[model samples]
Target: MTACGLPRSGPTRGQIYSGSVEKGGSTHVVNVDDRVNRAANYSPAYGFGSDFQSAGQVGADEVRPGDVLGLSIWENVDDGLLTSMGASSTQLQQLQVDSQGYIFVPYAGKIMAAGNSPDELRRLITEKLSTQTPDPQVMVTRVAGDGATVSVLGKVHAQGVYPIERPTRKLSSMLSRAGGVSIEPEIAVITVKRGGNSGKVWLRDLYSNSRNDIALRPGDIILVEEDQRSFTALGALGGQTKVPLGNEQVNAIEAVAMVGGLQTSLADPKGVFVMREEPQSVARAVLGRNDIYGTQRMAYVLDLTKPDGMFLARDFVIRDSDTVYVTEAPMVQWTKTLNVILAPVNQIRTTEQGF
Candidate 1:
């Protein structure tokens, strides 16, 4: 009888399908102990609140074309040669840096002001006017300018190119200036591109971490992407769905719950598994094997029947692009046989007892 049947509560005999095993690649069997030890320690490049910092920043605010300057020149020494009737302060010159990068001045001809800061331009202008008047005072203010600009794209309210005229514009400030993120905080990934380098980070982290919210540099490209980090739940569950892990820094237990846990009666609790594709380096470190599984692609399993499995699930952090699979119990044969053998016997025994 024992050889002919197996209990419904226990996991049925497992088989490795031909398609499941490849000649060179095979899934390493993972159990509760492995999940608690190895899977719990698993970390990916973009997982576990990963910090991807900018390679470099735009050092300082630079003067560029299309910048408008408010120039106020003071010829304090009104020698009457330059001053026309008590003229001490020259009229404000709203000069816009032209395509040739030159701004015209009354006594100082066309002066190159594109590369120099307001202070530097002021000194340059004052020096040029020194021959004409003594102790010349010059003030250059960037009243209006697109000297520094950042390209903001993707899912944000005000998505466009914004000017960064002020010094030290932080990432959070820029995002706010661009009308904040479009959707929920959990579902957004902020990608920053600076010069030849680029990296991505969770918007949640950008909002929380001061280090990650670095200053925006001139020519920095910021993009707010929809959170793509998610785990797909398959097999005997309430529904087969992909649950988005908004900056997913959650554990296995939470992930399972979000995916609707299991289809209580249909799912075999002991057959719960997390399928991960680990990188070559991670796989090699986790498993002693240097095989293709070293590519951070590996399978991790958990048996809820175990007394400590539930506790271990809490520590097991699920990463991006992982698959949570729940295998169903093999109940059809057991149900049929139980009815066929026990039904008639129970009926006869009840009659014999005169119940």
Candidate 2:
């Protein structure tokens, strides 16, 4: 049996292989006829059989223009009366909603049609027609522009404007329409800004059991940020390196691991050092320029090699462009000097190869 609890079948002989039964019944050899019957009766619940319904309702009141309206007229004109009265039928061309949000009708001068439903516009036209003809019959329909468009930019697939047809369109709907996030599981970051206030929404949070509510308006902008995960593994490390940031938050331990762990082969792991760039304002007085220093200042730096440094690392959030550098041991300076001396030879060899 496979993981889904379906019996496995082989190509050579279409029969169920004999296996021990948990109920202690004697195993019977399955015949090809029984196999065909079982195969024919098999039904899967989670595959193509599952139908998808739209997440929200769409109504005509949600219609806007550049919208096309199809208008039809029905009148109680007697056939003989029409023949005697010389009644006529007229067909209009592609009627568009004008800039002022009004549609021009044959008899009705101008009717505001942009935000009104077809039934509502029909009633309005009926009222206008009542002035000239008693009990005039008319019909109005919305043929286009049921869909409203919004734009998504700053790091998303199909990062442009898209049209949404439903009024209950959510933020996730727009993201899906825009081809989801530009990056994958570990590097994706989505930021939703609404009413001048910003909030972060992770892809995992979106798909979690605890759903996050992100409503969308017509002009709302969603930004999917690129992976900014970076660490400068320096001093006392096995290999001084820079690690690329992935989607999830990277801590001091993970950052250190990227540089091949603490150089236990040379330096003391307990004496590791992390050098973070403190905000310029915190060291403003250190710059010895009083005229440039201001009170509205922000600064941050956390050392993670000390015993209590893990707590600081947990509390300290890395900023977008912040750099994290680890210090190497003093004994490593000899290796650095050797590399510095060989740098000229390496460059000369590279130049010779290019030539």
Candidate 3:
């Protein structure tokens, strides 16, 4: 009985297939081919979506509540309303915008500064003070504050609130102002949250895909995260462990090679298998059926012994949380059986020699 069957690294290809369609099991074991490869090819969607991408850039000159402003009023005559004894101009510095978005000018009364640009506010202030003072020249300068700022956190060199300025009016420029990402760009993921909406994209895509570099907005929250896409490699391989996908796309061939390739002396070239939970849509496409309504258990078989086996493996895409298993060669089980039977016989011979 021991010689008939022995312990192996994993189940044989035949055993796996036999149990696939069992009464209690719903696993679909399908041989991978060109058609299946095409149906199963997957690329994760990573973008900021249409609304975020189409948003215009933030107005850097626009003022908001909680900002500080500087105003200077100049009069043609030295003894004007805002001027000192001999000075033709007077300065009002550090005028903070109230919560209601109003700023008080000495002679100009309360003015709304939140929605207006500095130039517009300057013109408005000059017009208001013209009645009291003759041809008053006004200058409005905006100072950075918390009203129009964004918080950047996670995996960035600097985690803090950044103000929207001319140089940092867009998402990419703001990230740069924060000292860029500390993690690898290829695996870094950037997420932006504004109000009730949020979007995510790969860091590399910001430059490669122009649409991903969206404009920044006030009160936006930006986060940089490490990519979590990875798969588990087990059975007749050099090592059994969870491997991170370092690139945007990883195929079966690359995944196998990632874990130090298969154990040359023990791996069965015909029993390489990729196991995953397939979504209903992908399942229907792969099986050429429409009855599957939910996520299904799927086991894709790859026969490396065939002429096109390597090509099929190369074309087969590996998704996150997938399991890549390679069974041991058939001779390995026979070798284990022979060792079990020969152990007792060798022990008996040793006892006879001792007597």
On lDDT, the leading prediction is 3
What clash count does candidate 3 reach? 0
Flag regions of model 2 displaced more than 4 Å: 1-60, 76-93, 151-162, 175-186, 191-200, 209-213, 219-229, 239-241, 265-317, 331-355
Question: Where does candidate 2 have its weakest 10-residue lDDT segment?
Answer: 43-52
Clashing pairs in model 2, backbone N/Cα/C closer than 3 A: 186-247, 187-247, 229-245, 235-327, 235-328, 236-327, 236-328, 236-329
* TM-score of each model, in listed order: 0.69, 0.57, 0.82
Show pairs that collide, candidate 3: none
- Cα deviation of 348, candidate 3, in Å: 1.5
Off by over 4 Å in 1: 1-13, 17-25, 32-36, 43-62, 65-115, 128-144, 291-296, 333-355
Q: 1-355 in candidate 3: lDDT tens per residue?
A: 8955665667877778887855355799989999999998886677887889788987888889999999988998868987889898988999999999999998789999998999999999999998998888999887557789999999999999999989998889999999999998989999999999999988888888888889998899999999888999989998899999865688999999998998999999999999999899999999999888899999999999899999999999899899999988888887888899999999999999999
lDDT per prediction? 0.72, 0.51, 0.89
Q: Candidates ranked by lDDT, best first?
A: 3, 1, 2
**Backbone clashes, candidate 2:** 8
Task: Tell me the lDDT of model 1 at 251.
Answer: 81
Candidate 1 local lDDT, 205-322, one digit each (tens) = 7767777877676678999989787888877776688888775577878877886778877787777778877666665655655664335445667778788889877778888788
* Candidate 2 accuracy as TM-score: 0.57
TM-score of 1: 0.69
Model 3, position 116, has a per-residue lDDT of 91
